[model samples]
Target: MASDAGVPDPETQSLDADELAFSDEGIEATLSPADPESDIAAIFDALFLISRLAQHNFPARIDIHTFAYLACLMSIYSGQPANEWGYSFSAVPPTLPYSPTLDGAIDRLVETDYLKTSKSTDVTNLAEFELTPEGERELGFFSTLSLLSRRLQFLDASTSAAVFTSSAAVVNSLANEPQLAAATHLNSSRQLLTESSTARLYDEFEALSQAIGKTDVNLILPASMYVSYLQSVMRATAEEATGEAVENA
Candidate 1:
């Protein structure tokens, strides 16, 4: 039941007859293993957190190119070669051409304000880039472990009915698209699903949950969709509440 990391494997755990697990003390066991995609996202989040936590350790400037190239830097920092990380540049979109250098990608990142050249550094010819303050703050949102865990617990709670409604919304939206709903072949469905980010995310999460031994599709799909719904609701509520509080001042 234990993984090489010595942690109990989520897939090996038994659920209660009622469809969820709880400790004898009535505490819920909500641990879940992130899928490969989620794991990569978490890695980026953690890297951003680590960089900010030890801001002084980083040079006044850092470098970033494309996502794949940046991922290579992250791998190197983790004492790995880029090839060992198994990154695919084509994963982004239209197939990327092989370039001996990443100068083009680096230029784009610099123009986008995600990375900025260091003002204090005196190296004239060398182009160094660093995470702009805005970039750090954006990545930092995903870096909050407490928030992520809290959201996971909410998804696994018995009272989580919101996710079902969210999943239904996804299904309803897809059904309303006559072109997609009428597709008889798998390729058509795949293309339509891939075109919509929401549809794609739900599909991926549902697959992950099922692969990890979730027997009830009804439960898993809803839970997967609910996470996205909760994020939107939480963000909107926070903005509204903060605005009202400011107006009343």
Candidate 2:
């Protein structure tokens, strides 16, 4: 079945299995950067690769659309804006259509064993998911791609807003919690993520230990959380520190 754009719409082609006209040789499609339909394929090559790796390694049924959706969620989960994910029903940044997209994407992933979902009955009606061992294994295969894709996709001014808005909201919510702020400020003013003046290094264990300081309850935070908080706080502190240093000078 030929689509309006002259491509065989997969849906239509699937409907009439007997009339399917494409063979491996006939299935030559390319990403056209100029075409709206193809723009996504071009931009999301890396994200698609992440999902593709999972599908290849595990039994994940990751279609292009499913991959894009999961990558979008991961972007959000990783602190990038929805725009960087480049997904919107109406075509705009952070403009999500509804929960169906997320639900379906998660369902597809979970059913295929590419992801695992668990409920925190320790809390009231609370549930969250983490990547399964299979998911993590697949992620490791494309770890660099996943990392780079998340960063590259949000390499725009909009990322600052997406990150900052949530950052500020979180900081304020914990405003009364001075221990965290104290740890935050101390960690930030030192800029500990990097090594000293001449060395390059990171201490994952120390960072993760600090992050899990309050694990009596049911919760977990990624080690990256501390780095993000420290970095953001340091950015603000740097502005003030520079102004003060200049005044002193």
Q: Report residue 246 deviation for candidate 2 (angstroms).
A: 44
Tens-place lDDT digits, model 2, residues 1-249: 112343222222221212222112110122222444333322333233334333323212222222333233223333233333322311111111122233344555557676653443454113344566776665555435432333333222222222333423322322212222443444432211111210111132233334455322211133124335545655676698899999999
For model 1, the local distance difference test gives: 0.33
By summed lDDT, which 10 consecutive residues of candidate 2 come out lowest?
A: 192-201
In model 1, which runs have C-alpha deviations exceeding 4 angstroms?
A: 1-54, 57-106, 120-125, 142-249
CA-lDDT, candidates in order: 0.33, 0.33
Residue 21 in candidate 2, Cα distance off native in Å: 44
Identify the candidate with maximal TM-score. Answer: 2
Per-residue CA lDDT of model 1 for 22-46, tens digit only, reads 1121101212223343233333433
Error of 2 at 136 (Å): 0.3
Off by over 4 Å in 2: 1-85, 89-100, 120-126, 144-249
Clashing pairs in 2: none
lDDT, model 2, position 179: 27
Clashing pairs counted in every model: 1, 0
